[model samples]
Target chain A: MRLPSLIREVWANLLKKPATVKYPFEKLPLSKTYRGKHELMRDRCVGCGLCAKICPAFAITMRSVYGKVSPEVDLAKCIFCYQCEDVCPRGAIKRGKEYELASWSRNEMIVR
Target chain B: MEALRKAEENFVVLKAFNDLVLDVVSKDLCTKCGMCVSSCQVHAISMTDEGPKSVGPCRQCEACYYGCPRSPATSEELLKASLSSEKKDDILGSYNKIVSARTVLSEVKSVAQDGGVVTTLLIYALEEGLIDGGIVASKSTIEAWKPVPKVALSINDVLEAAGTKYSNCPSLVALKDALYGYDLSKVCVVGVPCQVTAARNVKVQPKAARKIGDKIAFIIGLFCMESFPHVKLAQFLTSNGIDIAKVSKFDIKEGKFRVYMGDAEVLSVPIRNLKDYANRFCETCRDLTSWYADVSVGAIGSGRDWSTVIVRSDEGAKLFDGAVQNGYLEVKDIESDGIESLRKIAKRKASKN
Candidate 1:
């Protein structure tokens, strides 16, 4: 209601940075502890299939990969709880910060 | 109408599912043998991991209460009805003959825990039309080393279910399904001592067992010192630095619990060390060899790769002799030393429990 005080408030607001960012064009940095996609170290995997056994979502399947059995994750069904990371005896499965996982086809969502 | 009212007033009050829960399940004496479930005429009882729970209204029929093996009212009568006084041994019960036997079949031997006598005898019984199916404890597909009661219809099914599971399996629960769901009129049941006692109780009980008891062709009992709770056993093994999934076989011999992965021995611990994992109900069990089973087969009092077979009933003797004569199993007399050891062990279990 005060003209000079209102003008000063407007000037201060104009100098402040916007709270929201353009997500697609200018993305914010992801936290270091973010859990998203899985990265399985094929050599470290013992072919035990413990990850598949402990997976509550039933997303991990044991499959023969390059002559050794390994876990193949279906990202479409996975809850990304990182249980595979926790239960891996050999430290084979790692959580990655790659959350942009939308795809046109379900088959493409699987991560071997 | 006056007579009917008088009769109704004089009706005797018999114990029902509630009494079973209060007397046995509540007291933690319930062995989870599935006898009560199968004994229920109205399908009121359902077997759970904890024990049998009432899923339907109780009709006060007293079938479940009387037919339960752990019931105090029926145990004495059941023993009197099922066991004979002709050749009763203090520890081994009444038996016509005892011998060390091994299966002649290579297929059975490959997978058998001991001499493959149970599998071979079941196969012979199946081929001879003695039984339409055999109730066995088969390994659960989803969980490694977990036993699930299964009705094996053929030799392959019997062989597939070979070997011993060191955990308690409520095998009698599958009796109703074997009699009705599989349409098996005559089925052989293989179980541990408590389960054998439950099966015998179901057969001897006057009222509730009439529906499913006659269908049981034979009962093959396994000698058990004690059985471990599956979850506790798994935790014990895991805590001992043994991977449950990688364990291919488990055995208790010379007072040591052994775990095997393929052909190699992975871990060994004294049986006393795993006492904490043993089912509490097993502490009350006195039978070392199934005293009431038609035939009891166990690894005790026998050489390597041989099973000690004790034939109790005439039917069991006929089956064992037939298996031997038909070249399904090879039999030899058990040594005096072996008998002495068996008696000693059985006596210890009886007195300790």
Candidate 2:
């Protein structure tokens, strides 16, 4: 409540480091258990539909590529719940430490 | 000396207590998906219409964060377009045993709506002290899929959250709520594919672990078809002069709308009216059947009262075994062909990919 004391507190905060981190470069140190952007381990992923199955939002769909593989995620509908990663027994799906997911186009958000 | 010994024991207890508290603070893994908003049995955890605000207690049932798949991770390998066939074959071949409704019924029945499978299982876990609480989906309305995540404890509370909601319910937002609002340390959750995916997404975030990690102990997944949009549904019902609010018991029988008001057939509308209400977010979906649910249940390949279930984890299998042993459910081997039919449908749906 004291003006002088408040001024001292403000001055003390000014001397401290900025709370914001410069993203995409000096990334913030994520905790050991941080769940972030999704990373697909091509080899381990059997495409069993576990991620899609576990997804509560149905944002992930299995798109058949003829005789190839099926499974595609619509980033627009994604809620990033990470149930997919936990259900992936093969460890195919894992969360990464990248949170900058903005994109100018919807197409850019879709991950193969 | 006796007093000193007692003090030492007290110190140990205090240190352990402090450690537990620190661990809770250090493991916050909230993904902000909003599933908690729909899971509350008491109609708690509502969104502020702007961002997320508040409504109720964190029943300490870790349904939201645990069910979330988007913690702080990178891309999911399942999202790739090249891993489908082999994965399907593996699931088929590895299908020696499955998690059945009968197995999960006892503990989940009274607590669950309809079949009481999921809710019962969660309750059993809590009763056995396997978990403190759970995150579950509660129906916000009969016509819409607007589910809110709720923290549940008692069986009655969980059962209140029963019934299928056909709209986009974000259970992950409850993860944030569990972290910032409630002091819950452990929880289990139930969610659909997208909400689960969000859990995975949040796993990789920097502060997610400290804010919402280690708090989730189990994830209960629900089998889902595509959900519908809200506005489109309102229009469809309005066109038919069906008072959306007064309407009770919305069901799809033979792909047709079967409306009932307290056991009385009020009106029946073509499924097409509802089909148009299907969320566009669904068509692009890859898994018509859930392959990732620790235990997934749905009516895709079975009768309405019967749910086709898939148990994918050891914990799920354990719960299934417990459910069966407890006499909450009953099951027998039908035929692998039922599962095969599901695969074919999935294939056909995937073929559009």
Whose TM-score is greatest here?
1
lDDT of 1 by residue, B2-80 (tens): 9999888866456878989999999989999998877765577889899999998865656677677788876555565
Query: Against the true structure, what is each candidate's TM-score?
Result: 0.73, 0.54
Location of the lowest summed lDDT over 10 successive residues in candidate 1 chain B: B205-214
Report the CAPRI category for model 1. Answer: incorrect
DockQ of the candidate models in sequence: 0.01, 0.01
lDDT of 1 at B2: 100
Q: What lDDT score belongs to each candidate, Candidate 1 first?
A: 0.84, 0.54
Candidate 2: list runs displaced more than 4 Å. Answer: A1-112, B1-74, B78-96, B103-114, B141-146, B200-213, B253-257, B264-275
Best by DockQ: 2
Candidate 2 on B197-273: residue-level lDDT in tens? 44433333221221233456655666555566555666666787776676556665544666666668777876556
Residue B92 in candidate 1, Cα distance off native in Å: 0.9
TM-score of chain A of 2: 0.75
